[model samples]
Target chain A: MSLPPPAARPRRAPLALRVAAHEDLGGGLRWLTLAAPDVAAAAEPGQFAHVRCGGGLGPDGALGTRRAYSLADADPDRGTVSLLYRVWGRGSVWLSQRRPGEVLDVLAPLGTPFRLDPHRTPVFVAGGTGVAPFIFLARRARQKGLRPLAFVGARTAAELAGGEFLAAAGAEVAVATDDGTAGFAGTVVDLVVRALEETAAAGGLAGPSPALYACGPHAMMAALAAACAAHGWPLQVSLETPMACGIGICLSCTVPGPRGPGFYRRCCVEGPVFDAREVAWE
Target chain B: MSDLTTRLGPLTLRNPVLLASGTAGFGRELAEYLDLAGLGGIIVKGTSPSPWYGNPGPRTVETPSGLINSIGLENPGLRHFLEEDLPWLRTQGATVIVNVVGRTVEEYAAVAEGLAGADGVAALELNISCPNVKAGGIQFGHDPRLAAEVTRAVKAACGRPLFVKLSPNAPDVPAVAEAVLEAGADGLSLINTYLALAIDVARLRPVLPSVFGGLSGPAIKPLALRWVWEAHARFRVPIIGMGGIREWSDAAEFLLAGAQAVAVGTASFTEPRTAAFVVEGLRKWLDERGFATVGEVVGLAHRAIDGEEAVPLGQS
Candidate 1:
């Protein structure tokens, strides 16, 4: 995938953002509101920020820093960007210890965002923290006068994030939990398949069939991609891969492209967002 | 204040810390994390005569405290760099060293010739050792004659001080160093990433799309240090040592091994301000040890064994 010229999209540096608020969403998850006006102003649904942890003392404390998290919500006027993250490793553990009013190093407006065509009814599917970007997409759609439909899946009730926010925004949200502690008693992909089928049976996919957007585990996305392909809906996905630098320089985040298995694209630059069908999911 | 001024031949660095090329893309990618101008110097990503998309993806894999990559020297070509990136880089304050690569000797000379009189361009690093690309990369690095030829060719066309980046993958790193120095190389950068590979047992195939990648980080530090140590012992040319430098201690090891300066590569990935942090650490280490100028610390390990210096402090 050829990236946009550097002139078109100016790269942003990590902003020393103050933590406006912090909420503990248990099961090792966090909801952070960062005071990064620059990021809030430029952020889009799928693009993320690279957050560097361990802002302890001098430069040494900042070593082995940073992880990318999709923006869950952004308010340009309020100068805030929201993120929901699970404590997965040492980095997250360090991030978790951060208190309000503390400054964290954050690089924003990174990668391509999930595109929302106002005419197309947006169907967002997410698993776990994958629900992050949809908060922005949902709000953006509402601003454009579109009421979105969403499906969120988690292993259990504790793992689900942003369900309340989606509902508050007047979205038709369907929740699925593997343990049956939530809406649908099975996998999210199964719920998604049923939702599409029911919508189609009710009036032959009337008025712009839903455009599919998903972000989650690789397996979950692959399943969604196949489902979208079968139903003939345009699908976009945000991929999560290991990255050294969230910029184009490192070449660490690679994924196969539409060119076939042999050709690879830098995920950090080429995409964190890609057409679901274009990605060569092995 | 402990002086960090470093001299690599005619080129004088603000300090001895450098952002290794390819690691810091054109010096802008890491701008968000640290002040780019604060570091000693920046060896921007390798550029060729024209744009190169680089190798197929699956370009990197992590091992231990290191990273291996097959980025194939992907760059926007010399013209684009000179026209677009250079103006912004010059404003950043730190010295900028343009790293040039090519599929052929003429292309190398042409790139250098283009940057010959560019303002803010401090030096040029000849990356004849990139092992990711299918051709003209490690081939020139491993061959003494080819390495010297490329060095001589670029040095003639480029007016600025030229540093030949030596490949640890060479048949004899010292030989390559000596050849390049003889061919008018102003300095040297030792131990580009070693050519390496990895396999996914589950997939039962090579992990990287290129099948082989260059290994970097702490995993290759000792190995890179050996070459830097050897090359420094044999030549007067200042050597910039890099492989896996995560912290100040790693930078100290390279200095002790005889590198006049240390380039932070994979470490920058971990911390964009790693070089700056290293500069801070080096300063702290120096002042605490009763040393002043960082120049005073260069090759300190080579001078003494046990508790003495072959030449006492301030005597040399």
Candidate 2:
């Protein structure tokens, strides 16, 4: 049967309203705060908002596509949210150019969110822009009175958008930079490994492993996964793909996983998040 | 009532409208925006014998009125398809034309061999036109002999109909089309992306990592129609016309210009529902014109032209 004539779907409650946008946290990266009116009723960590960067296309009448960015901050009761992104190309550059008072089209509370382990200790691993989602996850962890560790990596200290926010959320935050312009001189994995060694030496009361939640470049995620595997730590990773339609329709966001014999999953629908063990990293 | 259905050789399409590979992916994403089942058929993204990593960062760039893509034919490979994507696609209820690209005649044969018995796979559209890869693409497409060899190999390996997708970059597209037809290709999809490029001013670098990418969208429509008309005139095999077809009017031009079917590409990047929209528009057009069938319009241009020595229309 032919699909019902194309109609706009408006079933979702607005989780956030665009409150402000400006040059912040350094070059090519912009911070936009959205006010989520409904989140106060019920907001969960690990959920994201899909924003339609209004100027996504060029001047010659191209369709402006939408992108799914991590919600950096959210207040369920206050009905506010935040997002941080780097202006990589046209779509992102268009998003950064938006001004305050202009409501960007947004689809919120998407993807399989970060699931907190009730018994296991939580560890947050993020790389640069990948750090966006962890801010909320860390905040939610603290709200539930859970202590989490956040290890962040960037090219330098200036690129770290919400380091203070993570610390305020009570995460034992560690920083890593490719250039020795920040806390750790190497990668976040190096900091993580060093932290593990120190914890091991102290005969830590926390178990030998931590439940790892990571989001970053495939290389960083894979490295973190391998590190967690070596130490026998369970890990979850938020993967990225070039998504055309943020809905399940465009299989363009397909990712190879180790689940079934021919395991493939859509990042838009199945998850922007998955258990690291189940994902076939590529 | 108009008969929107048409035939490309033995394969019967519900209408003249079809979705181009790569641009449409599977029909699922587009189905959300428009009714996919209402269209003629769906040609999936280029598949291969093995999963390909494609190219690195900077694969796609938006040019003025068009797009340059160097996606390098990134796909999950054949094994993943036979086991995963195909089964799911079959449930959608459209003619599933699997677009396959090969690095060698043998690999093309191997992939065609595998798909020969695969369920839900109606035909194989050999993508000999991809410009991103250094191996087994434009090389075969530009040269008539290699195009014939690859077509013959795939034809021998698969019992299903074969549609050789030709590149516009070649000087003599009609010659290449004829060779493929002689080699047993049942049909043809004319005009894959033309070789093109874009520059990044901010980084002072090439917009795409490959430096040169294949151009598609409205920019290449006229050229694609020329090739389709020329190839259709020279060869008996049915031609699937594409490139820069964004709307119903463009699709109508291809049909009146003698295309057996029309594939909507680049437009899908901007408007996911463009294919279904075109299909609906074509059906209404036929009904209003009081034509009984879409086939009546195919090669209709040949009848009207004062001269017919395989000349391209809309040219001085």
Task: Specify the highest-TM-score model's number.
Answer: 1
TM-score of chain A of each: 0.91, 0.87
Candidate 2 interface RMSD, angstroms, 1 decimal: 5.9
Q: Which lDDT values do the candidates have, in the order given?
A: 0.82, 0.77
Give the poorly placed runs of model 1, Cα more than 4 Å off: A1-44, A49-66, A72-110, A127-129, A139-145, A152-170, A174-209, A216-235, A254-266, A274-282, B283-292, B306-316
Per-residue C-alpha lDDT of model 2 across residues B1-316, encoded as one tens digit per residue? 7888888887888888888888776666666556556778889888889987666654666666567778778777888878877876766666889998889988888889989989888788998989988897878999999999999999899979889999888878878888998899998898799899889888998977799988877878888888777776666468888988877888988987778899987666545667877988887777777667888778777766746454334321
Residue A169: error of model 1 in Å? Answer: 6.0
Candidate 1 per-residue C-alpha lDDT over B1-316 given as tens digits, one digit per residue, 9 for 90 to 100: 6787888788888888999999888877676566666688889999999887766556777655556788888777888898889987776665899998998888899999999978889999998899888677778888889989989999889879888887787777777788888999998888799888889778999888788888887778889988877776677468888988878898988887787788999877755667878989988877677677777777777667545646444431
Which docking category, incorrect, acceptable, medium or high, applies to candidate 1?
A: acceptable
